[model samples]
Target: SQQGEEDPQALSIQEGENATMNCSYKTSINNLQWYRQNSGRGLVHLILIRSNEREKHSGRLRVTLDTSKKSSSLLITASRAADTASYFCATGRNTGKLIFGQGTTLQVKP
Candidate 1:
């Protein structure tokens, strides 16, 4: 079953601005991870927050998880044109099946 579902579906921002995207999932998760994709190809692992964790940050990326709410949010600070890509939230299962969010497309204009 598809669990992680990203909101808005798309986003646009200017360089230096901030971009925020959200994800909502169905079942309990062991760990939630964020990924970035360029031109709809390949996935770059951004950050991962465990079920026991509430929040985490890595460089320009910040991730928050609320297992109680079965949701997560991703924030990108100081956005750059290079940041133009699609962001997705993924749920990891002990079964080794990784479910990915639909994705939020972000276009950072320079």
Candidate 2:
């Protein structure tokens, strides 16, 4: 998101543990999105929350955005080995341009 920095570039957690990733951006955004990418595959959009929204959830995934801080976080609950992937946050502006974060690699061990 806006060429933001993601905390814990790499993370390893147990299968049942929850995984959390944080991203901080440099500028304002219209909306923010989280994506997941498997080993060598393309990114899959996980969730998108508008600037007006504070939080959103999908299944075991929770996403929170703080426009005030220009930051966001993604939380994966009850993580599984299959959840192992690289997660990225992308910020969209009124100009229709999207800037992505460096991404956080999560490894869920069985």
Candidate 3:
């Protein structure tokens, strides 16, 4: 079953500050992915960290996963107004099924 939740349903920050979002899942996962959706647009893949991995980074995006705790966090450093979007964390299982979290809406003001 898809069971996940992201903390801080909404966040507001100034440009250049960092934004962090947390996600918690109820089951084991093969891999975890973070995505960004700009308003009405499709989700843009941000980063993916495997079950064996504890942390990963892509450009200004950083992701950390704790399988034992069944939780993950996404951090965006030096956030920009353009970074304003909804962020989601999805868990992928051995069956190739992906379960998504509710998402965190971020607003970066300039």
Q: How high is each candidate's TM-score?
A: 0.95, 0.97, 0.97
TM-score between model 1 and native: 0.95
Model 3 agreement with the true structure over 1-110: per-residue lDDT tens digits: 25878998999999999999999999889999999999989998889999999999899999999999999999999999999999999999998888889999999999
- Runs in model 3 lying further than 4 Å from the true structure: none
**What's the lDDT for all of these models?**
0.91, 0.94, 0.94
Error of 2 at 45 (Å): 0.4
Query: How many angstroms is residue 31 displaced in model 2 relative to the true structure, after the best TM-score fit?
Result: 0.3
In model 1, what are the clashing residue pairs, if there are any? none
Clashing pairs in 3: none
**Candidate number achieving the greatest lDDT relative to the actual structure:** 3
Stretches of candidate 1 off by over 4 Å are none
Over the stretch 1-110, how does candidate 1's per-residue lDDT look in tens digits? 28857886999878999999999999888999999999948999899999999999999988999999999999999999999999889999888888998999999999
Cα RMSD of all models vs. native, in order, equals 1.1, 1.2, 1.1
Error of 1 at 30 (Å): 0.1
Q: How many residue pairs clash per model?
A: 0, 2, 0
